[model samples]
Target chain A: MTTEKINNISVTTLANVYFDGKCISYGITYADGSKKSVGVILPASLTFSTGAPEIMECVGGACDYKLPGSDNWVRSEAGEKFSIPGNAKFDIRVAQGFAAYHYICHFG
Target chain B: MTTEKINNISVTTLANVYFDGKCISYGITYADGSKKSVGVILPASLTFSTGAPEIMECVGGACDYKLPGSDNWVRSEAGEKFSIPGNAKFDIRVAQGFAAYHYICHFG
Candidate 1:
């Protein structure tokens, strides 16, 4: 099942807007000091480079993601997840007319 | 001083996208059951109708807003706040080249 909500966290009041609003996210800090982000990607093909390894868990909608060194685009739907290594670059695309891709990013 | 973060809360994983992505927000629930939202408004002019009386507190960037029945647009910068009445409509605008307007929306 998809994780609908995250509990007992502190949220940064400001949003992190990237690619001129094509992607938006909020940083969240859990009670144990672990960090994550809840974000959405609008209809666009975008490349992202990671600082730390991340597990992207889909909560709503969907996207096709291509991991580093992969030629195939894998679909990640609600309740699905994909992992990306630190210092790696990957591509994600949400097609036009579809809903925005909503996800929770777990960082290492 | 600006309120940089909110503590002891839960966050909705999905986002509320408005005006075709010009405005985006994530819902937040406090430990005591109060609710708020962290959001950003990109460079655009938009109108919003309120269900509950709202306090829009700026945490970063800025916007010019016109309340219902007002002819003048007031500037709300970081650390500033403005209130809107329930059942009323208001207008907010961010300049084309300026940074996105980041805020915490508190509801009554």
Candidate 2:
């Protein structure tokens, strides 16, 4: 897709809410038909398992994430990106001062 | 609505894309049955008319807005909120150094 199409893609209403609303995100389809996501995570520690390899980008606020097999959680601020392997689960936490942690998850 | 419900509310798929894709947003519903919105605005100036009074909150990045009948544009930084009356139109402009503006619009 061109640059213009990516900025104005439609926001898909379909979503999944997990852990009693702790982990929430919405579905989005690019012009070429690949599906992705963008959502906000509240200040809480949660674990998520993804079926596909994902590129998780931190676009807003602050978050700490531990990829699978890692013992220590690393800080992620706005504008940072991380790659998580497919079929793997990771842990996320948000500390004080951030209203909500916003992110974009890219899937193939 | 309770605090937990608000953060994890599902991101709705249904949306309206206007201005040849200049303004894009998603639909959200509070637990109290009121409709709201959350989306990103690209770096461009656009005009919008609202059908209901909207509380425009700046969650990410910066923007300048001019309410109905106003000649000056006021700057809105992150964590700032503005109220736009129903049936009024406003102008929004985003300038340098910000990627995309993220916002939450509340309607009663």
Q: Against the true two-chain complex, what DockQ does each candidate achieve? A: 0.95, 0.04
Model 1 ranges with Cα > 4 A deviation? none
- Fill in the DockQ of model 1: 0.95
> Distance (Å) between predicted and true CA of B72, model 2?
40
Instruction: Write out fnat for all predictions, comma-separated.
Output: 0.99, 0.00
TM-score of chain A of each: 0.99, 0.86
TM-score of chain B of 2: 0.84
Local distance difference test, each candidate: 0.96, 0.67
Residue A26 miss distance in model 2 (angstroms): 1.2
The sequence of per-residue lDDT tens digits that candidate 1 reaches over residues A1-108 is: 999989999999889888889999999998888999999999999999999999999999999999999999999999999999999999999999999999999998
Chain B TM, every candidate: 0.98, 0.84
Residues B3-49 of candidate 1 have per-residue lDDT tens digits of 89999999999999999999999999988889999999999999999
lDDT of 2 by residue, B14-46 (tens): 233445334556665544556667655656898
Global fold similarity of model 1 (TM-score): 0.99
